[model samples]
Target: MATPDLRELYLSLVCLITLVLILVGGVQVVRHGLKLLLPDPPPPVFAPPPEPADSTAMLKPPRSYEQAWQQTERLRLQRQAIRGLLVNLVLLVLAGLIYRAHWRRLQIMRRT
Candidate 1:
């Protein structure tokens, strides 16, 4: 019925948090791999561009908006890829930190 010591509680909490984070990171890596492997559903195509407000406007035909939209989509996809890579990189660092801590501890105990 005794309460757990603060240090033990904190350690357990940290271990639990690290385990959950590793699980989530692993899932995301798997999902990204699947996205690469499986063909994604086709992006819904947009309708043809509308005519400009000016009745006599014919010099440029006002297609700038649609072009901008296409550019935006490209940028968004690139951002997503970058974000995914960053998340994986962080996960790698955390995993290495956890492994190094355990390894050094083992080395110390062996010397003792």
Candidate 2:
């Protein structure tokens, strides 16, 4: 049996670390994407009228349809950003794996 080379072991370890980071980052990106897609609780439709004695009190206006549409658009942008991030991460992970495979093949050829 051939003894393990320290350099080869170190390379393998580094590759494993990169793999874990890629997985973790992908998961976080997906989670954030889901959070963005989820709908927020609707605002209360009606509020109690202010007391007549409290002249300084102002009634809160209900959210308009335009305002709601804008909020939805913002959420859509957030989801799109998350999608881009995840896609980039997947590409990076694929590249890293290809590089590691090539490195391993070279190492094996050198040993023989």
Candidate 3:
């Protein structure tokens, strides 16, 4: 049997690589989607009110600080999930496009 030409071989290799990339990207996107959809419930934050004191009252942190810290943590988690989702989506799309293009080229080469 005749050996495949270099162009065809290269195109086939690219198609395979791109398909792998697409699969990995798709998996990551799905994982990220699940993370966003069913995110772990944020742990409860509780801080007891400071006891009444004349001098130390000014030193004690307010209850709002605890609330603010919790809010910041939640926001950070949300941001990470969103960023992951976006990045994975971009990877999936680009890889899919590349795979399609290379597959089409391979098909055309085979037709000749």
- Best by lDDT, which number? 3
Residue 66, model 3: Cα distance from true site in angstroms:
2.1
Candidate 3 all-Cα RMSD:
3.6
- Lowest lDDT 10-residue stretch of candidate 3: 46-55
Q: Number of clashing pairs, model 1?
A: 0
| Model 2 C-alpha lDDT per residue in residues 1-112, reported as the tens digit of each score | 6765776676666667767666676676676666566644444355467667665245644457547766777777676767766775675677578657856864785578
Clashing pairs in 1: none
TM-score of each: 0.51, 0.50, 0.78
| RMSD list, candidates in order | 6.0, 4.9, 3.6
Error of 3 at 56 (Å): 9.9
lDDT, residue 25, candidate 1: 79
Clashing residue pairs in all predictions, respectively, total 0, 0, 0
**lDDT by residue for model 1 over 1-92, one digit each (tens)?**
65656654655556566667777877787776655455344344455455777744554435676577666766666567557857876896
Q: In model 2, which regions exceed 4 Å deviation?
A: 36-59, 65-111
TM-score of decoy 3: 0.78
